[model samples]
Target: MTTAPVQKSSYDRYPTVPLPAGESVITGAAAWHRVRDLAYERAEDRPPLIVVDTYPGVDLPELTRQLAEAWPTAVIIDVEQEAAKPIEEIDARIADNLTDDRVFGVMSHLRLNAFYDQERLAALAERLADRTAATVLIGWGAALTATRPDALVLVDLARWEIQQRQRAGAPNWRSANGAEDNLRKYKRGFFVEWRVADRHKRDLFAKIDFLLDGNAIGHSSGVVRGPGMITGDAFRGALAAAVNAPLRVVPFFDPGVWGGHWMQDKLGLDTETPNYAWCFDCVPEENSLLLSDGDHAVEIPALDLVLTQPRGLLGAKTYARFGAEFPIRFDFLDTVGGGNLSLQVHPLTDYITDTFGMHYTQDESYYLLDADEDAVVYLGLKSGIDPDAMIADLRAAQQADHPFDTEKYVNAFPARKHDHFSIPAGTVHCSGANSMVLEISATPFIFTFKLWDWGRVGLDGVPRPVHVDHGAANIQWDRDTEWVTEHLLQGPEELSRDGDVIEERTGLHELEFIEVRRHWFENHADHDTDGTVNVLNLVEGDEVEVISPTGAFAPLRIHYAETFIIPAAVGPYRIRRTENSQSTRFATVKAYVRGTTRTDQEGPALAAGNKGVRS
Candidate 1:
């Protein structure tokens, strides 16, 4: 069904509770007077909590003074009602802590935004969400669509109509009592609320809130949190404020509904697998993406590589791309990941058209996540095998047993952690069973170069397409294996705890969008919700929040690390270490935008007027 267009309204009367760590909650004039008078009369049992006024882009001796003043110190940062700092610098300030036992509470200037950036917002909020019930994260925000008077009336009507539905069985139940009661029940239903985010669910019943409750829900919104943040450009100011401070921060997502999937139930494609190794197409069901450890398909420089780390689940990926303009948008794909992948090479665009009817060749790389001892990759034509003999082997199925026939027909390399193989357009390759991989490749520039087969049928009861004729035609005369073996064998340095990863860069995967990193948050993993989505992955069979990438996040409960994908399209998101419960071990993937290339939209060579974009 089409979404009811959003309508804007304001709810100025709504109220929210401020943090209550002190007598004032928020040290307002009233709070300050109480403390000031206490000190004057020597009635204060505890030292006074002084509020320091600091300037924007300003560094004061406040932190040092606070620490020197007491055994335990705290900082409350507030700028003008509308203010912020660069998210990166804000993060650096908050990450500095005395110890887990010493509390670290970093708050933004107040997350008062009006748009729903599901990925960015959710990633930021999830960071504060805890798996255990010990600590609860409190978020405050508003939700609104556009502006329209009639829609506002509809919202009001809906609120009244709902109250009537649930009040049906109430002792005071009566249709005349109106629908607002039903609206209350709607909010109380854990099941329904869980179906969508708390805010979206509320929005559904908002019409009723408007109709009977006197427009309690904002047309835009008042202060609030998670999922149903106020709608429109309202959040831009809030987000900007957050990004400007040395505060805990991250991206977020609004749990709203969206649709799109590539792995359709095709005549031959089988898109089902509890395991998501092949979900390049299941945008709605399960979404994943390919992330390489380099730039521009560069030379397989190092030995080890981390491809396709896991992001949370399907929601993570979708929300990340909401409202984004991408050259090649990615999500969890639909692929036949289990079983032995066919031995194949992808035909470059040149080979596809010249040798086969297909427009492009499919030369792709698989960043394996799992594998068995028998796991082997077939890359390239055997060393010195004759073309006719190779074709003969395909006919007799002779290559099946010998596998790597002439050192050229195929090269068998056992799969291991972070291994990479550069399959030239014609080098045939297949990933064996029991292994999971993050498949990365150029756009559909070519089709695969299949050289052999297990000749197996997928869940759909269909064998994959075989491009033997084209594969044979496009096979590189002399193939290279050094880059593949070297890249896979060496690269990813099992990172050490600098305690914090200040910043660094790697190959192709330009620390673009959000750069992902993994670490522990619970066990006091010295935590704070930095306002980022933290996928809870109990790799130790324990629960924890995280934001890694790939299929790596799961299996951790079964003992594999799980990932949380935080969308970057929105304003800054944050992650807060909820309670001091489980250990917070996770990989954080930071987001960045790639520099525009000739292929990108409106890049220089394009229409002259396209030079300067988005102000």
Candidate 2:
């Protein structure tokens, strides 16, 4: 319950893109002045109409109070109170998606417009038809109240910040559940609120006159403060620059029941917290991006880049396959000097699609960054295990006096530094204590069905959710010790070598869509995105520089344990050791979507197998 103490760290947690020399962000009172000036410029004969559309979790009362102070004479309408449906009605509509389960829910297909009453919307529009004085409309769906506003301002918030607010007792949009559990709150946001808001947000990116940083407010002791505003041109330019070069999202660390001290020591995180369990470095859905002009920066959701530049950031092949979604995810899991992770299995593809509305399932791999001598990874199942008996034992473990004998049913493999273990869907797996892992996998990350938690509770003093019935239906009984040893225990195979640079193919299992490659170099290494986005991490060195061959982008310096992205449009680039790096040899692990076919010059096929469906 204590706040995490701030500490100086070498990790570049707040990565930013410098704006052009002549352009700078406007903040505080100046931001409101600029908005007023833009509104006057957009005015024709009558007074202008300004619409401030907001994402959920924005400080509406504070923003409105400020707007009232700035424009005392303007008529301000609260869009939700005027046009949105009642809280009870809205809850009923989304009840199916926001299921009773605390941690899981079906993905919603509803749009923002569905939350509003059409008759009320018409009435609100009628009132603003002949306004003499300036008028202002604001709320989550404010833009829906007017057809063509003279001035449109978008207020955006990152999902991670939203989670922080929820944990601090903020309710979901238009709901009165501030006292609810954090898991249920997160489930509602993940399944229903965020989906509808994103659908509405994507349609406004092309037309907004200005973008406001909702995350910048109320930062009493941070490097940046709120009310930051940027011209639409600057906003679009920043996103364009990110797609053409290497970039990183702001990383966030959280404490867990099985958390460890590795991140605290390595990443320079807060030592006051009990432990750091996870670091979300590349999950765009819950990360923020900073756009700066050297002197000042504005923080916005990283999802904005994906929504605005889907084709450029994700590449044509990836965008077409996933439809504006970033399919790959990279995160850190620390269990060193702590407890083991929960025994879990991901639902098969067919099961996920049928039950959760997800097109793809989570197929993941753990790349050990560092490990203690006693580190181990539980994978697959012990050979010749009885399926029915295993399920019964797992069910019985839920009782107060029983503990599931994990070693009796699962195969434990020795874990070491740089070891890669492939985990296809339906395979049971968990990392044991004393291991620092860099997990790379598909982005459907919340689908894990925990079968056991080593008889432990969460940091909140609550028992974690267990999905034994779900796991029972999806476990691949055939994936026993022998099958796992043959297919899942991956050893690096040398793919090519040139002088000091060596490339090796690491396994993610042929059944999985992601392809991983490790590169080691003393001088420099060449890489091509090959029409797909590449996510890489400096797994072995202190620092390295990423540069484009054609001078397409400015050089980007990456530090140890940092994850950076190279968009597909980058074409050809090179990574070389920085002058400050102490290590003679450097290493990086890169991941991308696997192509359906291979060329003769690319080498023998490393991944070739059909993903099976659940029976």
Candidate 3:
């Protein structure tokens, strides 16, 4: 069968939700001028105090300079310099969480106030209270300096942007370790800085006077880089709109040792990069959300939507279970024209909880998007393989100059387009070369325990860290060839079919909390969120349209390989072929929390049975 050539540049790198009408976003000089006006307008009685609380990784010096330039006579206080604990002291306090391990760390419970000197904070607050001049306080913990401010502006940066800045040699907040390894910097941000900042920022969301887009800063001329500012009410409205409709997080691509040419060619990414290995398409913790007001869009951490509207976005049960976390993650693992992924295993739930203080583990699956004739997937282990022998070889491979004998122990299954491999936690697995993979998994994304890396160094020329001991402990020895074929290798088990739509249950393994479904439709497919969020990617065909049956949301067009999310509140929706699509049929693989129930009210014929359609 011949298929039309996939559209070039069909993948949307920047997906945004439209803000309500009349919601304006100001940027650059206008944004600065508006801050100046707000500072003056609220200073009728006391010294005007404008607290520009920032997420870590923002350019603080530049922000302070911009504020000074805007209000020449105002007193600008660098709150971190005045009130933050010394870098050495802060390091000592978070050392337990920031273990020497290169990749793993304990999630921190520390709040933003914990990183500041209480006495110094009091002194700064007192000093600001007595000052008669208009003062601007700016830093990560700027809001903590005042009980109430005349104008509270938050300069927010997305985690993905923060990572880019880290890659470009920016240090963690208040740390002078610009030369540190990017992984260690990321660990600090993930376990300590980001947690503390988000906790502090969440409380201020409703109280914020203005929201500034810090992700756009620090670009050279002709890059269209400038801070965008929106009113607090408008920002809240955008967040509400996002949770009530289908939306997408801004996707980001990165290169790796096992990178491929597919994304660079198909996704129209920068061709200059050696290869693009990973596309973090729906990892909300690290991705961003762009809120556009027709003309300008402000980028903020997508986690903000989860943090602020957990109920509306995640639904009541999921929010209650995960506690404001977007537990499901969907990303792309590209190995086409590249090397195999490192042999790895995720920790079991009990092990992860005991070791890292995380409540859940990375239960994941790999859905093949495209594969070459020779593509393969390393999954489970050869039947009756000695666990001790495998562990010893893995350990020796990590220390010595030899590559681990992969096929000797692990089962290598031939991978084909549309094949789904279920990889529950503790299942040893990796996507082999010449395959495009859509990884649907739980969101504890960084806890991968690599057993073997095929003896390759990273792009930085440093040997990638292999956790043989951790992998040995976590590997489920029982998941052998026979067990894997019967369990891990799953199906497109047809659940139901209407006139032109067929829905099938795809395996995420019964051990996992996530459920997957594949829908093949020539005309239209009916779907309901069933009181839980649904994430899907158009795995087949050029383009499709996601529409609300009741006009609950604007129709969203999804191209092949583009991932989008339907919030639990976006009850009933339909996916149909777009007028521009040339394909005879289309397929979408969707995922949602297992056991979520459908509402009493259904949409159409195919949506009648609760179990007939999943995700």
Candidate 4:
């Protein structure tokens, strides 16, 4: 199943480049040096061609002009000027109803066939490549056909920055948000196509010459050279020898109807927004990792790490199964002091593929982070459930704005701190009010079919749409109260214990592609990756430090309620609790790909030793 790039070559060996101490952001002079040095190395008759890859809102023309000033002999060409068709023509090519997620989801993945001609664009690059002394093509996909450049500068920007800049009437070239028409405004509000397209761009990291972080002004937040292909022990050495510490991908926050104030108060986040509903803690698809090379901290999309070192990050067997795609995700779903999350269910694997063009289903488990006394998790259906009756009731609740007897149809369980409730595809579930949930799930993040929303409007004061039919089709009618109670209420089974360090494994369902293990300890615990990526959270600790085998990498300091990853590349590591607590014990939940299969006469068993490995 793994389609990851193979056939090892010299490209796989990346040597560590040391940077000056106490410096973090790359200055304009430094950025100029990278390009100038590359050109000097080339020593060609024709000026070295440079490609600057930037996002929609970046001031790439300004950056190109700066480069031209730095190198008097260089020529700057903004690729937008050479577009095959007018910008207006491309803007008009967008599909109608861009506000609709379903519409945008499909259109985003499709080729830009409706807008521009790739062949014509390639021809334009070919022409421009020969015209200038040092041809500098600067734009999104500007150098699509211009073979390898003497230097490639990738400027990364965050989604929030793009949206904020767009709203502020900044100079952004995104055609969808260019004009002031009703359709354009509608498109601007729900533009996530860039988020998907950016994932495709990250795969080309091996081709990048210099990575410039543009999260701040001057595009000088940091810089990093292109990473070499990662494999085996070399991968471990790179991670252990990381310039700063174990990586913590930048987290993204979004508001929802069921958002709460916990994040605002605890994390000291801005309270001006409505509330923070979800924190994308470590989702590579939308998150970025900061590689601090001592002098500057370069921010690259998290997915690039997995792509560059799939076998090293995800182990050989797991990489073979899923390729470079990181199978597990750790995120926060906060409903504390807020409304209940919409009663939702994700589609089956086949259903997701057929409906959303996604590869897999969203099988998830909610590990309660914190909850109020009355908090509850609505899961599965009650005994003697009638599918037709439930559908009719849900329809009435959405259409007529009449609330249904939710408990009468769905089973509710008291959600306490650390309670784990499995919500695999087709299993109806939702986190009720006053609860902070650490949602661990598969990579397909947004296939939720909301059947009910407690008969309330969205935070925007608009009636949220419901997918009654979609929910009905995907609902697993067989997962009644009895099945849910017996199979979904995941409890820990002791794996191994050495003195005060106890390891327990849970979530042994056959439907899961990954396994969960909790490490509770007083001092420190050593664990092996077993050739699989490990995603973990300090759910019950004040703080902890993760140390690599050689201690070359700085120990990563993780705070309470923080999530981090130990790539498969970092083979063996130790997690030590750094702060003393009243309970004298801290707990961390670790998730990874299942190395061994477990199956009985009935199916996979959830008992101790039924699956494998104690520690």
The numbered model that scores best in TM-score is 2
Order of all candidates by lDDT, from best down to worst? 2, 3, 4, 1
Judged by lDDT, which candidate is best? 2
User: lDDT at 355 for candidate 2?
Assistant: 90
Question: Against the hidden true structure, what lDDT does model 1 obtain?
Answer: 0.29
TM-score of 3: 0.95
Compared with the true structure, model 1 gives a TM-score of 0.36
- Could you tell me the lDDT of residue 157 within candidate 4? 63
Candidate 1 Cα misplacement greater than 4 A, ranges: 1-277, 281-338, 349-363, 385-388, 395-408, 417-426, 441-446, 458-463, 487-489, 493-497, 500-584, 588-615
lDDT: worst 10-residue window of model 1: 297-306
Q: Per-residue alpha-carbon lDDT of model 1 for 1-615, expressed as tens digits?
A: 343332232111111111112211111133223323433343234332222221111112332232234322322222221132343433343332211211111112112232134455445334323222111111112222111111111111122222232345321111122333332333322112112222332333323111111112211111121111121122112222222221111111111011111122221122232333342321111121111112110111000010111121112342244211111211222223345556666665565555333333344444443345566666544455577877777755533354434334566777653343334355556666555444444334224445665654433343434556656776665664553343322343223344543211111222112222223332323222233222222222233332222322111111122222232222223333334334444332222222211112221222221111000
The residue-by-residue lDDT of candidate 4 on 155-254, one tens digit each, is 6665544544554455335554443432234333334346344554654465666655555534322223432111122222333343223456677777
Tell me the deviation in Å of residue 187 in model 2. Answer: 0.8
The C-alpha local distance difference test score for the whole of candidate 3 amounts to 0.86
As a whole number from 0 to 100, the lDDT of residue 347 in candidate 1 is 61
What C-alpha lDDT values do all the predictions have?
0.29, 0.87, 0.86, 0.66
Task: Provide TM-scores for the models.
Answer: 0.36, 0.96, 0.95, 0.81
Q: How close is candidate 4 to the true structure, as a TM-score?
A: 0.81
